[model samples]
Target: MVKGCSLSQNGSSSFPDPLLYRQLVGRLLYLTNTRLDISFVVQQLSQFMASPMINHHKTLTRVLRYLRGNPGQCLYYPENSPLHIKAFSDSDWATCPDTHKSISGYCTFLEDSLISWKSKKQTTISRSSSETKYRALALASCEIQWVTFILEDFQLHYTQPALLYYDNNSVRYIATNGVFHERTKHIKIDCHVVRECLQKKLFHLLPISTHD
Candidate 1:
């Protein structure tokens, strides 16, 4: 779970027992269902299931140590929280040393309470940071739309254009700008779903400093 730590399948001996590593990673994956903080790290560890290495085991132990040190930590929701929806999305572009795939992470809030979150690697490699970020935004937007539908089913209505925060200005520009350029044409058509949501006033994209 160390910040800026990138794991790879290079320059390390294979673990003697890959089964143990797989079992441990499976448990960690289950933990991520509630432990959003560990989701990214667990996703990174899962990539080595086919052949885990010594360094991977070391990193897994570190995650276990982190869990031990923070046994009481958990996501909490308060009763009577407001029904407004907001989301934050980000991606680490081409961070996977083996496949060179990007990792996307997003968290959704019902007012001030965290309600949903995810961390997963992109299926296809992104050629630019903007593309990677835009893909992340698209994923977050889809989740927001689903959440909005569920809320409606329960008779909870929120204001139009739910707020979505991203650190990439280019992505915000792409979502709002109608024109497409050669640089953006290569991006998958499915990823443009965010722009459709924007056109429908489903969500407003805002730029934020990465440190924020």
Candidate 2:
């Protein structure tokens, strides 16, 4: 999908064949398992599978064109790369014009190689940008925990906590501090998970500039 392009169910022109749209999107969704670059766009297009519009079809064609232009693209892991796990979490708050739900995205790397990533809509609506960000952090924490477990099974262990980078300072503070506020009450339970992960040294939450 193009940057800053937003799609919704409210488009004026509907596609002629919903069946064809669903078939094409289903294939693209399968492709995302190995093609992380298309994951976000695939998620957005999958949302309209039930009733795609003409504009949605055009968007899907663009994705296909992008793929055709980069047929050799694939993830590569060098044999000598380090095994340390690092993650970056981010979210677009209330971005869905229809449901008002945020979109959460994260990418995990083993050294310099990208191993796991996701882009999905949140299950619940968040009242603030911080809440949405914290939710994304929580999700990333879960993913990191899973990755660590898998590594442990492979007899690989890290001496330090996995580094989790985020662009939201409020989320970093909420994960480290024990204080709670009225604005954050609804999200306290989610925040607690991240706090517990921190206390156990599962991961270290840090703030970074958005451009990085």
Candidate 3:
């Protein structure tokens, strides 16, 4: 349901009655607590909750229809799965229609089960692809730290330097090396934080080819 809504529309609500729309959207957000599959879609819908338009309502209806059709479909965590933690992250460049801030999204898994994830609009507008990718890495770094803390609470020990997999080599390079090109000077904060995390051995970015 929420999955369909997320895949069906980009941001920018096309509907009306923003107050009512936001109320409904809020319900969806609340529902995401137990519905990890809907997290991405709920996050997408949340972006338009402020000033929903007619199109937004239509999109929301589509999500409802999808939910109606697949009420039984939901994420399942295996009881016997191992406690190993791993994370994957991706970002879209300048995805916002208004401010042009990129959207950073990532999902964390405990063995085969998803534990946490988010899709959010970045605070600073990025000037290039590298900046957006770096922002996503930094955001993922925060998630890694939280997950590590959670693991510690449970008395589970994940090896130091949690693995973070990304598809972009340039982003990987920025984290692995400190060479500051003129293009990435504007994104100094993101680069610095990511590098710091890397240096601390809190997480290491693993390069994966796009097709792989």
Tens-place lDDT digits, model 1, residues 48-155: 999998999999999999999999988878878877788999998898877899988899998888889999899999988888888888899999999999988988
The candidate, 1 or 3, that scores higher on lDDT is 1
Better of 1 and 2 by TM-score: 2
* Inter-residue clash pairs, candidate 1: none
Q: Give the TM-score of candidate 3.
A: 0.83
Clash count for each candidate, listed in order shown: 0, 0, 10
Better of 2 and 3 by lDDT: 2
Which digits, one per residue and each the tens of the lDDT, describe model 2 over residues 98-205?
A: 999999999999989999999999999998899998899889999998999998998887667899999876777777767743347798777777888898999878
The stretch of ten residues in a row with the least summed lDDT in candidate 2 is 174-183
Instruction: Write one digit per residue (lDDT tens) for candidate 3, span 52-154.
Output: 6676687678777777787897678887987666789989887556667778888888777888888787888887887888899889988988898888898
Q: Where does candidate 1 have its weakest 10-residue lDDT segment?
A: 181-190
- Runs of candidate 1 exceeding 4 Å displacement: 181-183, 188-191, 209-212
Better of 2 and 3 by TM-score: 2
Q: Rank the candidates by TM-score, best first.
A: 2, 1, 3
Pairs clashing within candidate 2: none
TM-score of each: 0.93, 0.94, 0.83
